[model samples]
Target: MKKYLGEGLLIVFSVLFALFINSLAQKYQTSQKVKVAKESLLKEMEQNQVIMTQWKEKHSKILKHIDEIIKNDSLQEELIKDHFLDIGALTGQENLISSLVTSTAWETAQATQILSELDFDTTQELTYVYELQNSIINSTLPDLVDIYFQRETHRKESLLPTLIQFKLHFNEIVGQETLLVTLYPGAIEKLQD
Candidate 1:
């Protein structure tokens, strides 16, 4: 009876020890996954920050030009005349709204369920950023702005309402981008921690 008891105890201990090791391994694997996903997200955010900075710079100039058009009749006339005479000066600014901010890593993490492994706060922050990115990418505001820009350029007519609409949409996107800029550092810090 003593021999049987000892054997039973040994078997139970061995099973428990195996389970503990397996649990530890699983935890380590999860930690590594979280680290990789976080690093990918941080890198993605860094790229976005750079893109956003460029966009802001370019758009600042475009917005200044738009302001000049709205405020100075002579400038509007000049731009319209220039636009018609085979001058491609404003081409870059005209296509300003067409740039898409991508979030490929975020999408990949979402698809792979890596986001679930992250802490709640980090996940929420990323969700917000990605949502803003999606909003920008999926927006029809750029199309509307392009059409309005074409009309203004071709007709040389005063389309204050159309320009106002474009400005409003553009400002909305800028505001979202600003919020993303604010959120990224905190998210990156949390991920590193």
Candidate 2:
């Protein structure tokens, strides 16, 4: 009877040890997934931040040039009289900024179910940032197309107000993007640590 009891105890211990090893393996796999997801997210965030900063700088410079032109009564009269042909000279053919936002990492993480492994707060913040990016892209499309047509058609007086209005809207979007970029670094660092 004592020998049987000893054999039973050994079997139970072996089973428990196997379960522990399995748990550790599962934990390690999960940690690796989280790390990969975090790295991908960090890369995407950094890229978006850089692109937003560049866009903001370019937009501000263009707006400044436009403001200067509009503030000068003489220039405004010249543009008005000449039908704003010089606006093309000032703004150039490439005035419309293309969207530089990317969502591949986010989409991949979602499709692979890795996003669920990320922290709740991090997921929420990422969602908010992407949503803002999408909004900025969609909102600016019509204005950009309008600017293109205006420039192409040389509709000076009409284009000026439209450009000014678009600039205002662009500034608001840039402000929101800047705020998101500012907040992203800290969150990424925390996750990395």
- The 0-to-1 C-alpha lDDT of every candidate, in the order given, reads 0.68, 0.70
**Tens-digit lDDT string for candidate 2 (129-158):** 777777767766455556545654356547
Count backbone clashes in candidate 2.
0
Give residue 156's error in model 1 in angstroms: 3.8
Name the regions of candidate 1 deviating beyond 4 angstroms: 82-100, 140-154
Tell me each candidate's TM-score: 0.80, 0.72
Best by lDDT: 2
